[model samples]
Target: MSGYLTTHILDTARGLPAEGINIALFKIENGERQKIAETVTNSDGRTNAPILPAEAFEVGQYELVFFCGEYLENHGLTGGNLKFLDDIPIRFGMDDPAAHYHVPLLLSPYGYSTYRGS
Candidate 1:
């Protein structure tokens, strides 16, 4: 099977799937970010399917914006005070678009971490 772009979110603070989190995928064009797709994490903390299908993969700079603050607030993981993170954006390039780009985010109310995955 061919590879594609995908992502998953893990709420480290809550120790569960970060369900219903909004995610947007974009590609940089002419020094500006252009929207490609937007999706919300399912109950399993993953998009319904890959963000970019194998056939649609192309070499370019891409970005993934994860709306963590709202997810945390709606899930009761945050208090009434203003949340620390609003929207977290991960920017990267598809050096080899043919290869799978698995970007996974491990998130908390105050911080988050992400890296290229297999």
Candidate 2:
């Protein structure tokens, strides 16, 4: 198998996949940030393609910023009424380039959680 990065977003409050949300992937080098790729979620709450394909995989610090606030607003949730979590930034690292890294976000308006998935 080859190494790559993938992601998923689940709207825990609605108990459904978060469709049409934007996600950006970035590579960090020397305290500076570089945009690697960006994609929007499909109906399945996943990007149409891998954020980082195997051939383009690299070893370094990375960040996945989710447009959670916009998504919440689009879903008809008033941000002014409930504002806690927005534009969630999840930073992680990858040292190996031959293993699959699945980063899934379980999200809510007030809080969220992520982990290095299988």
Candidate 3:
């Protein structure tokens, strides 16, 4: 079995899936960021497909940039010019090539949390 990367966002404040949020996946190499994939969250707060599919998966450092600011603004949760939680970047490493990588974000207007999920 080959590993792939998947993610989702839950609005902690509203207790619902965050929809229409933009997410960008980047593979980091030698301190440089290379964008690999980009997608928007559906009604279920998940992408239709894995951001990093098995065939393209590799063991390395990666980052997921979640455009939380735009989502918050759309939902009327913005804080004027500077929002506390804007673009949330979760940087992690995938060490196993045959394991599923499920990174889920629990998000609120002022805070967020994430973990390796099943």
Query: What lDDT does the true structure give each of the candidates?
Result: 0.88, 0.89, 0.94
Error of model 1, residue 91, in angstroms:
0.5
On TM-score, the leading prediction is 3
**Model 3 alpha-carbon drift over 4 Å, by segment:** none
Least accurate stretch of 10 residues (summed lDDT) in model 3? 73-82
* Stretches > 4 Å off in candidate 2: 78-82
Best by lDDT: 3
Better model by TM-score, 1 or 3?
A: 3
Write candidate 3's Cα lDDT for 1-118 as tens digits.
9999999999988889999999999999999999999999999999999999999999999999999998898887776777888899999999999999999999999899999997
Q: What is the lDDT of residue 30 in candidate 3?
A: 100
Q: Evaluate model 3: give its TM-score.
A: 0.96
Q: Per-residue lDDT for 46 in model 3?
A: 94
- Which residue pairs show collisions in model 2? none
By how many angstroms RMSD does model 3 differ from the true structure? 0.9
Question: What TM-score should be assigned to candidate 1?
Answer: 0.92
The collision pairs in model 1 are none
Name the 10 consecutive residues with the lowest summed lDDT in model 2: 76-85
- lDDT-superior candidate, 1 or 3: 3
Reference-based lDDT, residue 96, model 1: 79
Candidates sorted on lDDT, descending: 3, 2, 1
Distance (Å) between predicted and true CA of 44, model 1? 0.9
